[model samples]
Target: MFLKRIVLSLFCFHVVLGKTPEIREDVRKFPDGFLFGVASASYQVEGAWDEDGKSESIWDHDTHKIPSPIDDMSTGDIADDSYHLYKRDVEMVREMGVDFYRISLSWTRIMPTSFPDKINQAGVDYYNNLINELLKHNIKPMITLFHWDMPQKLQEMGGWTNPNIVDWYGDYVRTAYELFGDRVKYWITINEPTQICLYGYGLNLLAPRLNIPGVADYLCSKNLLLAHARAYHIYDEEFRASQGGNISITLSAQWYEPESELYATASREYLQFDSGVYAHPIFSKEGDWPSIVKEKVARKSAEQGFARSRLPDFTPEEIEYVRGTSDFFGLNHYSSYFVNMDEDTINSYAVPSRADDIGVNVFKLNEWVLSEFSSTDYVPWGFYKLLNYFREEYDNPPIFITENGFGTYYTGLDDDERVTYYRGYIGAVLDAIDDGTNIIGYTAWCLMDNFEWTKGYTVRYGIYHVDFESPNRTRTPRKSAFVYKEIVRTRSLDIGFEPDTSVMTIDEGH
Candidate 1:
């Protein structure tokens, strides 16, 4: 035990020192059944958008519309061409020797018109093929029902802000459960409700972009939570016993540290807005929204001279329905920020959005080293701290890290930064697990680079680099892919081992 602490201390020091240090792989290995997997979203990876009778997703409509919002003005119309090339994807997963593969279902693909009557047989067959392929390769499937690819029909009816979306989502998810629930054992109802509510609605960033700012986001939040809860109960009531599956919602959280002790409250408020608002209603024992979120949004709405509140309130029965819905906290964490009080900006009303509700200015930590890829800082310790925050604040629920990885704008095979980042973060996960955080799994953000939403293909977060320029969308395994494959294969963080991506070989487990 003393030696373990010494090894852990050395690993932390190596992270802080920004230098390679000698370490024992077996000592640093994750616990048994600690799922080392990779994730991919439907719209991002699956092309053949119009093929197989699939209708237009909001992403399909948004990226094609005039004044495109994507960074490269690129669309996921062709994406990684995984729709036609899924066999290759399965081969890659098999090569990785991972325990599971996290994949999302496209709502438009399943029910193109967003109605119960029109079940796209081709779309259903495609997913069946994909799931069966994964299962054939001995890779467990972790399926996400919605990864922000709302059917354009649903978006036309006011998207998430429409109260009817609760039923709409319920019907769509129920259809999914009935069709695919037999094989899929791990289910994610929604992926990052905060992103859907805040980025897509509050800010005009994502698809079905509505720049309604403060008002649209709150309405969407309430509806989104209800949608997730309703789906969970549907699974619990109709599918759980027979399907034997676990259901949860994925929430993206970037750890925030106070810029100074003075801004500690601001940091806490950042948490309230970013994660607490979405998670509190479902995960917290007391249900309802976070007290800080409800109080602040109400106060801000009143200040803006709104009747009632911009943030909607949940009825008592609704709160009860939403609580205790998750079997695990599906977390998608990537980076960290240092937050400080910015009252002057908060008072100015130059821009009235979700940012104003928290009344804080956020920046990256001082010590973080930036890469050429994205503005994300490499602070693995932040992950450890974030896990502890959940452990203490949210009653230590079982956790599955659905997405955590490094992103770079460059598409290079030699991603030493990503390798180091993974090592440090995986080490941090082990540290958090040792400290009593109920974390069960850790999935790398991606299996290969795909169309990264608004950023399009500007940033690459995958261990395998996809040649978007190539007609075939050839996926070449990067050094990081080899490293990850080794980790998953060995179930240990073998820091000293160097992987050779030049050759292909499955682990002994395969």
Candidate 2:
């Protein structure tokens, strides 16, 4: 145990030290039956938008129209060229010993105008070929229905804020069921509604960048959840009879803590708004918005001179539609921190008056309550707490560690820090599983590094590194890939298997 700690420290230090860990690989200790997988999204990797009878999505317009918004001014123009090289992608997934491949369907790709007045055969062929290819290799295809890239037309139609979107989304879900539901057994309704509503509508950081007054984000939040529930309802009542698949939502969360013992009172309210408002309605036993959120939104709406509460009201029918819409919870976790609870103290920030739910003044383990923009606190144990919280709260609904990985500040094939990040984070997941959390699978954040939203390609999150300088978008496996590959292959971390520090291997691709 002491040796592992030293190795972990040395791994982090190696990023700057330019030296390597001397540990042996056989010493790894991951357990058996731990499933492994890699993930990618439609907009991030598929580049032939205009070629396949597919219409543009909001991301296409956002990334291309304002290239300057991205740090490297890089767009997903050719991004890994996965739309064409997906067979190679399947090869990589098979080689990695990963049991599942998680990918999202592009709304614009299938239903050109975001509506199914016409089903694009070419668009259907794209996913159809990809899905069958995965099955050929005995790899399970895990499909995410929507991953933030809403149809461009939908954006003009008020996107998620417009209540009509609930029906529009249901149509899309039903179409997907008709097309690929036969082979694909797992489905995710939405990636992260909080990110879409809070960042896109509140911070103006994502698609359909509309920082509308009270009506933008809150309405978007309500409609997004309703859309998810509506889609699930259609699948359950209309499609499940023949399809027989699992549907769930992938939620993003940052574990919150109070900055100080004295500040605990204040931080809880912040979390209740940011995390609770978004999650409680779906996960709570009674399936209604938390009392704090209902009261707060009502008071804020009244102060803003609105006749009705800005937050959309759920009809009894809508609540039931939104309630229990998940077969499992898809959790995308990365980091956490304690937060400053004092509202007045937090109000001093130059944050937009519209954004409170963002949980400003977060106290990372580094002892700084920085904003989420800069908080990369490393707390693996937080995931254990998270899994336990859900296990107890939601009556042990199954969980998939949908997305968990560390963001990097440096680059190299020898990603010791990433290995450490995976080791600790996944170790925490294993711990939760031991304590009886119904976590059945784990999928890392991404397969190859690709366009990262506003941050662009500057942040690297892939186990397999992609060279942006190369026109070919060449992918090279980082040392961490070997670490992860072994975990996938053996379904155990051979704390015993050391980094292949032997200078070089004569046998290539063995």
TM-score of each prediction: 0.93, 0.87
RMSD (Å) of each candidate, 1 decimal: 5.7, 8.0
lDDT: worst 10-residue window of model 2: 12-21
Can you give the lDDT of residue 485 in candidate 1?
84
Clashes of 1: 2
Query: How high is the CA lDDT of each candidate model?
Result: 0.85, 0.74
How high is the lDDT of residue 13 in model 1?
35
lDDT of 1 by residue, 452-490 (tens): 998898888998899988999998899989888888777
Give the Cα RMSD of candidate 2. Answer: 8.0
Model 2, range 1-510, lDDT digits (tens) per residue?
A: 557545533432322122212323444444455567899998888777677788888888888774466667777767777888888777777767788899999998899978889899998999999999999888889999999988888888888878899889989999999999999988999998878987888667787778664568888888889888887888889878887888888988766655444444344455567666667778877777766567776776676577877677777876776788888888898886666645675676433233443334665565331223222445766666666666765789888878887666455677767777788777777767777888888998788887777767777778778887887777777877778887776676565456663332211222
Model 1 pairs whose backbones collide? 373-408, 373-409
